[model samples]
Target chain A: MNIAILGFGTIGSGVYEIVNQIQAEELKDCKVTKILDLPQNKDKLDIIVCDINDITEDESIDLVVETMGGIHPAYEFIQNCLQHKKHVVTANKAVVAAHMSDFLKSAKENGVQFRFEASTGGGIPWLASIQKAKRIDEISSFYGIFNGTTNYILDSMNTLNEEFETALKKAQQLGYAEANPSADIDGYDVQNKVTISAALAFDSKIDMKDFPCFSMANITYEDIQYLKSHHQMIKYIGQAIKKENMYEAFVMPMVFASNSLEANIPSNFNIVTLNGNTIGELKFYGQGAGKLPTANAIVEDILDIKNQISYGKVSLDKKLSYCNTLLKEKYLIRTNCPIENEWIDSVECKGANYYITTKAISTKDFMKLVNSISDQKAMIAKYM
Target chain B: MNIAILGFGTIGSGVYEIVNQIQAEELKDCKVTKILDLPQNKDKLDIIVCDINDITEDESIDLVVETMGGIHPAYEFIQNCLQHKKHVVTANKAVVAAHMSDFLKSAKENGVQFRFEASTGGGIPWLASIQKAKRIDEISSFYGIFNGTTNYILDSMNTLNEEFETALKKAQQLGYAEANPSADIDGYDVQNKVTISAALAFDSKIDMKDFPCFSMANITYEDIQYLKSHHQMIKYIGQAIKKENMYEAFVMPMVFASNSLEANIPSNFNIVTLNGNTIGELKFYGQGAGKLPTANAIVEDILDIKNQISYGKVSLDKKLSYCNTLLKEKYLIRTNCPIENEWIDSVECKGANYYITTKAISTKDFMKLVNSISDQKAMIAKYM
Candidate 1:
């Protein structure tokens, strides 16, 4: 298992450190072969500084790990590796979650393995647990505080009485949040997580747009204070609900009692749950994001594939189903403006913020209503 | 996958509910063959209800789920099931942690899986995660708040400043603790958790007597107030550390900052961590114990055996080494008694309490020193 790391950043260095510390001495078939990076890079002993074309002819490169995240060249690098029949391991949840169908098919076609347990919950092995549990029952729901950055910011604001900017800076300093924290704070990070999770749990072909996302950025400090006054804690939650014949995915700030598991998850930690017919509620909580922790997930998957226990997942494209019954679900809308519309069922307002629970409506209709009110800056979240 | 529920208690009833829900599904070769309870039990379901003796002859029963708990019949019953070549799934961490060698040998001899993912961190598939991650790297350490009853009590004490008795009663009322919570509050419950985790993480052949266990039973509200004075929260933690040819297991009351993952774990939820060479550190948090969640684990194991996936772990008897080089760990000790011991490298007594930091010592030496102080109880909580 000679491996190649594609990036040299935090996670890449983390992967290198982890790989160098392999204690499976008896199972020494696994080893890092090439430290792949930009051409003319100097850091280590006899490392290959080659592009994807050069990698194709290198049969010595048995395992390729891509820590170079993004949807472009990372995707291209992985696709080329799969074509060249190199087993691949990655921490790029975005690439796998969005294009698992294509990758899985391509991997199978090329008789190679693709693994990305680090994609979802870093270091927790939540993916491995879910994958192994799949033999027992289909997962009915999957939910979590998937983004550690947002969780840290929110917890700081509530506990330390720090402003959002101050907390954001702290999270960045702590390396929990990126310089541009939109992906995390705006819920798209969680959206990617829930999308990937839904695809894995339900084995369905779910696009990112299939699920709605609502971030804490849309939420005000007033909402947090009010929720706290009511003995509730706010958590940016990524939810995937499976109904009779269909499923729903979204991310929103949930107001739960102080005793709720979601409420107590503080700082840059994560708590996730899965409900199955047989397993009831299964949860995984941990360091949601970090360099070594994230790298650990990729390493675990690499070892797992080494043992031939299992390879990532059977692509979502193979399990795609257009569940028509999910269209008739109800929506939960929270708004800052006064509800002059008939869609509002009940409103609980404190100061300028309000939680307006709405009546049953199709997802399509709810999206239409939200789009119509988008220009007004309505707090029209989504049908969570 | 024909399974049986041995005890018709809360967990057993939950298992039945899940099985009933999935009775008409396309799950491969799975169904409940029998519901085993006491000798005289009657239900409307069309499943076999027989004595323990009748269980061995029933060839249809492929998996035996032992939610009966305790050491007796549950252990003997599981042993019998393994002898009869039926896979055994249990939520009993106590039995396995104490007698893991015997159980693993028995399962191996009979060529049957003895799955216990529902053991320590209930509802969280920690055992399965450990099993899968085993292929990756050698785990250096593993530990967490594995007992929900004590966690619930400690969490209540942290939030509401409730008395221990009131919190214990509340935990019992909320179905988090047993009527007699001596095992939980007294640290024996968490002791078993650490034992199992150590066995899984380091393949350490150490039981309750191998390390030291200090309880939360004596974690007075006064102590809580002192911790609060330092802006800390108290939690009952079961943790393990591995050193060269040695390991330590203990359950004690710990003080942590407000926003820490371990500090923020609310109510009865449990969170554990795996510190391995390749994976670095992975943390799992979840509902540590519950009727439905435990049942889900049992059912999930059954499905694994049915699907021919390797869910059971290798025996820890042969590969029993807990050796790690990082032995000089840091701890925060709080005691009402004065710190006059030679092991106390540093001490600071403010009010009726003192915090002491100790030098590197073997776990046995550490406990002997802490226990040397006779008059008042003390807790030496691990930080790393």
Candidate 2:
């Protein structure tokens, strides 16, 4: 099985190394024949190719592994590979979340497989697990700490008593967070992940825009202290639920009890859970993202394609209506100007901020309330 | 695909219900055609059969699901089914731990597949996850609370300040523990589970006798309180490590910090972990033993077989020596017997008991020391 790795960056190179390191009998014939990367950045690799056509046009390349972490060309290259009758496996959440339906259609039309196990929970086998469970059970809901960078920041702030900025700086220093970490801190990373996961779990195509997201960017030390005083800890959570005929998907910084599994998840680790009708709740925990970990997941997908391990077809055939207003929960709001609302159950004026606890309110209403507030520094967290 | 179920018990009935509930396209042809059980136990189900040959000789049955939960007839029935060219799926850990290698050989010789995803961590997809990871990475170690009954007892004792007997009674009342309770409390249940998991994780056949087990039956409230004072909690842990040329597997009550994931696992939930060379640590948590959950796992295997989704072959071909002496850890011991050893780090005498904390000691040495003590009430726990 000849393989081509797109983007010889951290994850792509890691996949090449793991493909070489595989000692399993069934995967012995697997080999990386081509690597698509910038010519100057190719380093010492002889297999490096600067053109996507070098991979897609090669009839001998049985599979293409996309590790390029973006939407545009990765999606186009994947589609091209599928059109050329080559199976495609990827770790790019952005590409998967944006164009999964189109990729699935292309793969089906070309009679190939398109797998992205590393897209949602990196290295956790979460997406594959959901696919496995879906074979016999209906997945009603799934939610988790989806982003490693945001989890690291929140965990450090809670455990080490570091300020939000201090933890964010540390995360950036460790490479867990990038220089411009808006995609992670502002919930877009988790938004992309939850969108992909929800599509698989509920068997329905979920528009990323339909999944409302609340940023953990503005969370402060005072907010953490208040939550801790109430015996709660905050974690950036991405959740999706299958209601009667509707699906609710969102990402937010939610409160969990101190002893809950979500609260105890330390550092950059992620814990994603799926609620299966018959199997009950199953939680998968591991390194959500890393070079070797993410690469390991991609390798698993590659082997599955090589060995003809049918994950069946990628189907988002369910037609559940996307609705965000059906789910309701109390939220903690910290702001300088909260004005007034019927949902405000209690308000505590502390220093320059008014810490208000709202009654059970739908996510849509809460988003509207937050937007209506004039205070730009206002922060909100779901009390789960 | 016509299916035969051995033993019309909790798991068997659950499997029957789930098989009928499956809405997937590929599994729509599956039907439970026969059930092997005692004559008097067959109630309202016309598919129930009294004799094993009724299933074995019937060529219409394409698969057999064994949920008999024991070592004797269940093993024999599975062997017969495989020999008759029918795929076998089971939820019996005892039989799998005792005869997995033989079953694998039988299935291979008969050109059938034998899968037991529910054998180890009931409904957790633990073995399946290990197999998935093993495809690309070498699994180095695996450990966790494999027995849900013991976890419930320990968790209740810690959180609710319940006595050992009280917790055990509650577990029994809730059907988590058997009337005998020895399999769960004496560590045999975990011993069997670890043996099965270690075999898959390391690709080596391990004897149940090689995996030493320390009973949690003798643990008292005092032991829990003492550990609590040190900010530690007790959990019955089963661990297996792949050494240079040997494997070390054991089951014992171990101490973890209160904030650890192992400590926060409440009620009857089980959390099992596997450390792969590339993927690092992956933890699977869920209902370790329940009718619906375990049955759901069995149905997954059924679907895999129905869809012709090959999990590759189960090969216990690796030849590794089993040694229990290499791993070392501190131990907390409570006993009335006089103990004098170089490994004793500290001794605090409470009312009628000497609470001894040992230095880093091999499991072999610790077991020998505990055996030498005549006090039948002696309790030991590993500090990790």
Candidate 3:
């Protein structure tokens, strides 16, 4: 089986290492037939470097992996790979959450596998669990601390009683945070993650263009101290709860004490819980992301695909249809603002720290409300 | 895709409930075609009932489930079904752990799936994790609280200070135990589970027939108090650790103290920790057994098969294979009887608590030691 490495950076190099380390089975027939680098991206020199464009359309490359972050040629490269009937494996959440519907549709049409287990919790196999959970019965609710960078920062702040910025610096030093950590710090990373998890859990596609992705960006040190006084520790939590027939996906700063199961999820580790009608609750805890763990998922996909091909069966499931509908939730919010459910109608800001429930509002509706709040130059709002 | 269920008992009823409740595109075409029951078993009106013999040979049943407890015709029937190229899914651990090598080989030879997910940890999906772990790399160690009944008994004993007998009786009253407590208390159940886990983790078969499990069957209240003095709360722990080319597997009463993570595992909940070289220490926690959770695994297998079928693929995997080879392990013996290992030239025992970490010993040798001690009417012998 021939596989291609696309966007040979940190993830690409990790995948190469993973393939190199396959010792159990004889891989005499297996090879990384091609390497797709940024051409000038000299950080990756070990592999057989080729233009990223060549392998996307190469007939010999059976699998193509996208590791280069952001929404550039990565999208085009992955789409083209799928078009060429190559199975596409990616760790890029930005591409998956945004173009999942389109990509899944195209991949299914073209008979190619589209997998992104690393997109959500990098190291842990949370995506497969969702698929596995749904097999028994419908997944009613799903929630977790999906993002590790923010978790590390929050953990550091709580542990050392350090300011947020100092904790953020410590996180960056530990490599859990990017230098420009807006996505992780402000909840965009978690938003993208919950979008993917919501899709997998509900069998629906949830794009970033929906919902007010509640973040800890605006959380003050005073709030943390206040939470401590209430026997709580603040955490950036990502949740996707199925209420009624739809769903609500968000990341919020909640206060759970250090001893609470959720709060105990320490630095750079992820603990995810899933529930089906039949299977109560199952929680998976592990190193959510790292060079080794992320590569592990990619390798698993490789083995899964390889085994499928060996068994003379390969089918791409790209329908992108599932519990994609938005979630309406009763908000237990706290804020300093003169507001009502009507002004922030989608998510009503009620009494100081409370908010009215979004009476059957969708994610798109809430996104608009949040954008409107942002437009007013107010500290917008965060939902519970 | 059509399937039939046998034994309309606790797990069988769960299989029925989930088959009726599931509503997904991947499962729409899949159906439970028939239900098989014992000759004297009652429920006749609500579903199609067929004799187990006919169901086993019938060409119509693509998959057969065995919820029937004990060996007897259960093994013979399942074996016949696999020979007929019919996939078999069972919640029966007694059958699998005893003849996993035989059944797995037959299934592989005949191109059928013989799944027993419910056999271990109810619905925590340990087997799939094991399969993935095996494919990824060599599993270094596994620590599991696999038996929920014993766990409940231990937890009850800790919290209530009830005697072992009282706690066992209370567990029985709470539906945590079957009428026959020996299956759980005598350690055969955990021995069977750890045997399977050992095989899965070590890439080799472990003979339980050799070791003949010994547990805390005669533990006294004073022993519990003694454990507390040692700063440890006792629980039946199933562990398998690999050393170089060999592995050690056992079910024993270990001193899990308050400071340890395993101590946090409360009640009938199960937590299995795997220290993979790459993934560090990963822990999977959930309800080990219940009507819904056990049913959850059967439902998961059904969905897994259904998804494959819905995509025009075979449900039974041909890639994964069971290890049926012999291996060696160093056993640490702890017993009341002073069976000094120095009496045997090859075996060296230290004090009454024999630290028989002699050169790697075969399973047969380990069992000989157990039986020799048991022959002297030794109360308990724990192997580390």
- Which candidate gets the maximum DockQ versus the true structure? 2
Order the candidates by TM-score, highest first. 2, 1, 3
* TM-score of each candidate structure, all chains considered together: 0.80, 0.97, 0.78
Q: Residue A262: error of model 1 in Å?
A: 4.6
Chain A vs. native, model 2, TM-score: 0.97
Off by over 4 Å in 3: A26-28, A38-50, A157-166, A217-233, A257-260, A309-384, B38-43, B46-51, B154-167, B209-235, B254-261, B303-384
Query: What's the C-alpha lDDT at position B116 in model 1?
Result: 81
Compose the digit string of candidate 2's lDDT tens values, residues B38-61: 989777688889999999999999
lDDT of 2 by residue, A245-316 (tens): 798887998889988999999999999999988999999999999999999889888888877786566788
Q: Highest TM-score: which candidate?
A: 2
Better of 2 and 3 by DockQ: 2
Residue-wise C-alpha lDDT for candidate 3, range A1-384, written one tens digit per residue: 788887666778788876865665634456776777655754546555666656765677888878887888778888888898998888999888888877887788898888888888887878877876765457777777888888887777766787778888888898888989999878888888888888777666565555556657665554565556656666787877775555666677655543356666667788888887778888888877888888777777776666662211222233332243445543323445434456343333333443323344555555555554422323322333
Worst 10 residues of 1 chain A by lDDT: A375-384
B76: Cα error in model 3, Å: 2.4
Candidate 2 backbone collisions, by pair: none
